[model samples]
Target: MAKAGNGNWFARHKVITAVAATVLFFGVIGAVSDGEPDTGDEAASADQDWQPDAENDDQSDEAEPAVAEEPTPEETEEPSDRDKTPKSPEPDVEREYLVVHIVDGDTLELGNGETVRLVGIDTPEVGECGFEESASRLRELVGGQAVTLGESDEDRDQYDRLLRYVDIGAMDAGYRLIRDGLATARYDSRDGYGRHPREDAYIAADRRSADITCAPPPEPKNFADTGGGGNCDPSYSPCVPLYPPDLDCADTGPVTVHGSDPHGLDADGDGQACGGD
Candidate 1:
């Protein structure tokens, strides 16, 4: 007879216990080998995903776009407007003005009773130096002509005159004024004014302008007594003899033309009757 203790129990169930333990060990091993690790923490920590994206590592990357960010209006906004070629200047004059009268070298009175002052130019006033010559030359250039007007940044000046550039056919009247020394370049980029289109050309012409050459004033009335035989025009020393005819320096040889040369003896316009500056 055996001892009726734990030994009896062990011997009776040995095959069953061995089978159960073996099944438990293999099931755990299979689950661990086939089922993957927890990837959430790893994916969160890493720059790249554990499973790479089909198109790009980043959805924002343009390299291989698949399900990427949609393009914006700014994408269309830039290329068309900013990248286009620059434009050329267009013709400005739309209609023409018929010049009826010349107010001065730089001013005009049109047939419609509008007055326009030449933009970017200044000439002598009525009683100032070169006034007669400036006025005369303007008449010769554009009087009674139909001229096209080009506007500046400003349309009118302080005197309520239209500020414009006058053009006859292809000839620029303002440029002619500056080139001939009848007018000087003004109201341009220089001297605190807006610059006009032809400012540079006018300045260049002004540099090459002829020196202003006109006449000197005539003599004092009592500079010398007219007590010779006849009454004398006191514009000169030794009585020029009042003009029955307009005289020239050709008539009088080097007379002292002081106050006013009524006979027009001072061809050179120097202080002496017929001399140079």
Candidate 2:
């Protein structure tokens, strides 16, 4: 009976030991699984924090692209006004005509045989002080050249001449004459002819040309002193002492010539006093 009791005690002690070992094994497995979950959660949190930095880097790259594209609109608008400024003159649209003949310093005949009086300028007549010089300069400018005409307020003058502004190549003919001291700026107030488009420029040129001094007229020699026996009065006939001592063709009105041309004022000899028309 003593031996049996000892065996039962020993058996009971072994069973208790086995049950404790199983319990310890299950607890260790649970602890390991829970620690793995905690580690995974920490890793997930780290990944989440790192993702924001990557997204911020992408956003910064996108912001750089936006900044690079910002100047496109301004660059496109810069040429808008610069392109329109050069097209205002439209020189290609002007009409052109051939210059057939140079009537005088300020007048021309077109290829169509129409006479055109240059606007805003008056040159000396045939027998005037600077007539030959002015005519020769005008012929040198537009003779046989294609010219352009600009119209003014009046289309025609009382003498039926077409009034216009003549342009030879790139040059303004009347302005050139005025600048060269060959013409004066003038307008007909009685004929409703208005001031020219370039009147101010022509006046300024005339002012500059007026500085040239002209020689004074010679003292008139009487017909008797010139060995002529013709009875003539300077106020009535084409006599030696023309009303103005330096009487240009335009200034010499209609006068009767009895015997001789004492002043040699009749250039064309049309039986008229001063033939310069």
Candidate 3:
């Protein structure tokens, strides 16, 4: 009976050991599966965080480019020197007239056979103090040259000559004559004739010329007593000697007299000493 009881006790002890070993194996397997899932989750989180950083770096490199500004209106519209120059006076009507003849310092004959009296000034008459000089200067200014005519208040004078202002290039012929002391500024207050835009300036020039003194011509003498042939005699009735063959108004027919015309040849006191009647 004692041997049988001992065998039974040994079998029971072996069964208990086998059950403990089974429980330990299952616990180890469960632990390994849970650790593997945790490792995978950590790796996925790290990858997500690193992707957002790379995307931020790319976005910073693609920042917008800078733009330029435009200019203002004031900088583009500055005035120039050409804008400061004074403009020439406008005329009512401008006509181009050809100068066929220079009558005197203040008269001209047109190609159309019309006589033009230069308004605003009168030069010395033939045989007068500045007559020859004035006539010579006028020829130099407009003889055989084209001139521009500006009409005044009066179309014609009592002498039947067209009254107009003569422009030679950029200069006014009347003003030039007065400025040079070759002519005197004269205005007809009755008809308002000879008045001009530059009247005041012309009067000033005339005053300046008149201030200078000129020698008086000699007394009249008889041409018959001087043998009718001598130097110019200011005292004579004609104021010129006949013997010296001097150029009078008749002698210089239709010709320009640049030098002294000793005889009072220009009967009409025209600037021309000798011209067509």
Candidate 4:
């Protein structure tokens, strides 16, 4: 009661305020006694969302495959017929022809007057049995039809005739002639139908038909002229005329008679004319 009587007496009351401040600090230390770091601010900031780079998204899209394209018809073109067919290796035959004129057993003249001798084949004379048949067969095969021609080593023969082989389709005219026993296979320079497949048959038929089909030996027109039998034919007078009497006796024999040499038409030296011996 006496201290509260004057304000100067309160100046000495500092000890009481100090005791109260010390009690408050001891209470705050006891509340923070557990060890802990303050990280609540950073935890809230880390919860924000994150974003990737735009270049990384572009790289992922580029990893996918691209679309494919198809080819056109022009890129897969094939070969033509001309490329498949083989080219011919021979000289081409001249065109512009029609009828083939018969020259002999083995020769023919085109409509243009060009003579062509059959190649790789030989036929009998005109008087032979199969000669006319051969000519007729050739005419039937190539008289008015077009044909492919193949030449021999010799362009022109000594007789000034062209030597050639004729082909109709795939058939060889020469081989057909030989197969039918109408001609003999002759391998001079070129090979047609290869070396005579039916040679034996042709040869046998040729020998069998020899007597009747072949040309007969020329008979002595005047045996007196050839030194042979003349009295046998009494109707014909036996004249002692010299050989080569300058008379043509083509009617007497089956073949033509001509003096090919100088010896009075006696080629064998038999003291005869054409057919004495």
Candidate 5:
């Protein structure tokens, strides 16, 4: 430890040199930093007062407007009837016509002057059994009323009449006729004609039909018969059955020859009945 020499400034003034050295270190640091690029921490501190033109802080900070997705084809499409149950209307009748006239049990005349024949049924002739009953019934059903008509496999019959299944307010005319024994199911597949959609129903109705049997005439008893009172066919010499119902030679065998030959017992017009046999 030598004593301080006045000529050695650093040794004599240590406190003053220390302060100057600290100042010089900081000045050199500032000069070096200015010549090089600024570090991340220094740049961050410098940007503390910086502001963005938009309100967004980061890429994820922005919220986009919500959009609704369109529905798919399957979701927007209408429902199809593929899975629905098929319904069978009683007759599925479509066309309608006004009945201007009732011709017979199975025939009709339209307001338009067209003729229509009821399909799948046959009624008796004008003079045959039950003819009046059938024709009268038809008039009561559809006379001057509109009726629905359904086409069958057949279109027009040989008579130039439109063949169709007829219905009046849910009532089937042909079916009713067969059911009531007023008509028989005919001109269908059973008869070698076209098969109709209602053929099975018609056949079933025919089976349930009432059996129409025309009553036979009462056996006549002339006072001369010696058995009973007077009820006889005056046309015959012997006087046969009564006239409530007509009969041929088969009923009264070999009737006697007489005037008028009322029952036409004389087939050959020879005035003899049941005698030809």
Candidate 6:
């Protein structure tokens, strides 16, 4: 009976040893399979919880890029220097007339096929210095606007520049253009076309040109110390009162002065205001 009990104990010990060995083998296989450091099942549970977040990051990286923001109007840069100055006034003319074509500075072909010369302004002619710039500026001022032809006493000149008063309403593009130094305010007889309400405003701007420091001043007057011996016409002469700066007696033509209530020298034979000289 004692021998039988010993055999049974030996068999039970062998069975227990086999079970321990099997558990150790499985633990080692799980740790070594991924070649990752092990902190037991607790670390594995933490990593499994983070798996969904990793998948979300991968999806975000595959999404399309964001669109860039557009620049604001003030932030936008002008394409060129020409854009810095507006060419024409906004269209607000009471009368409607189509521009047939541009002849040169201060001149335009009308829809009625009339060649209208803009009055009270002289622009650089083609082939003259800065002519192209002046033409470009003129185009900008009248290119797409409605125009009206205000007739003058001298409808046509020797040069065929039709003298007329131009308006784009209160916004006087002519005056604005001259004030900005893009044109010269030239005068003519009011007997035909009369004065524009903005004429004085233009004159004021023209007067400031004398103050422009860039250009050279006019030649010294030839008048003696007595101040009145010249044989030139007093109406056109700069030695007399009211002549424009830098203009000589020879330069005076048939230009009329607008907005001055008092009578001045006459250039044309007509008794109207600003008729001559």
Candidate 6, RMSD to the unseen true structure: 20.3
Report the alpha-carbon TM-score of model 4 versus the true structure: 0.41
Better of 2 and 5 by lDDT: 5
**Model 6 per-residue lDDT at 84:** 75
Provide TM-scores for the models: 0.48, 0.53, 0.44, 0.41, 0.49, 0.37
Candidate lDDT (C-alpha), each: 0.79, 0.74, 0.71, 0.59, 0.79, 0.61
Cα lDDT for residue 168, candidate 5: 79
In candidate 4, which residue pairs clash?
A: none
Q: Write the per-residue lDDT of candidate 1 for residues 46-147, one digit (tens) a residue.
A: 845355675445654666556767789776656577568788888864788899998888888999888998988899998788988888898998999988
* Candidate 5 C-alpha lDDT tens digits along 33-110: 899975887889877867664645453355665578999887786757974757666884366789999888999899
If ranked by TM-score, best first, what sequence of candidates would result?
2, 5, 1, 3, 4, 6
lDDT of residue 37 for candidate 1: 75
1-277 per-residue lDDT for model 4 (tens digits): 6756665556546666678789988878877864455577577666554335686678777997766767788787687998889988988545434545776657888766778887666887866677778888888877777777665555777788877776676776766676667777565423444433444544554445432245666665643444336322322223333334444334222222233423234445444443433
Model 6 per-residue lDDT at 185: 72
- Candidate 1, TM-score vs. the true structure? 0.48
Ranking by lDDT: 5, 1, 2, 3, 6, 4
* Candidate 2, poorest ten consecutive residues by summed lDDT: 220-229
Clashes of each: 7, 0, 9, 0, 0, 14
lDDT of 3 by residue, 216-247 (tens): 96543433234334454443333345336554
**Any runs in candidate 1 off by more than 4 Å, and if so which?**
1-93, 223-277
Which of candidates 4 and 5 reaches a greater lDDT? 5
lDDT of 1: 0.79
Candidate 3: the clashing residue pairs are 103-272, 104-271, 219-235, 220-235, 221-235, 228-243, 229-243, 249-265, 254-275
- Write model 6 residue lDDT over 93-206, tens digit each, in one string: 457677757677677777776777776877776656555665666677776577766655557777775677665555555665577676777663333445644566667887
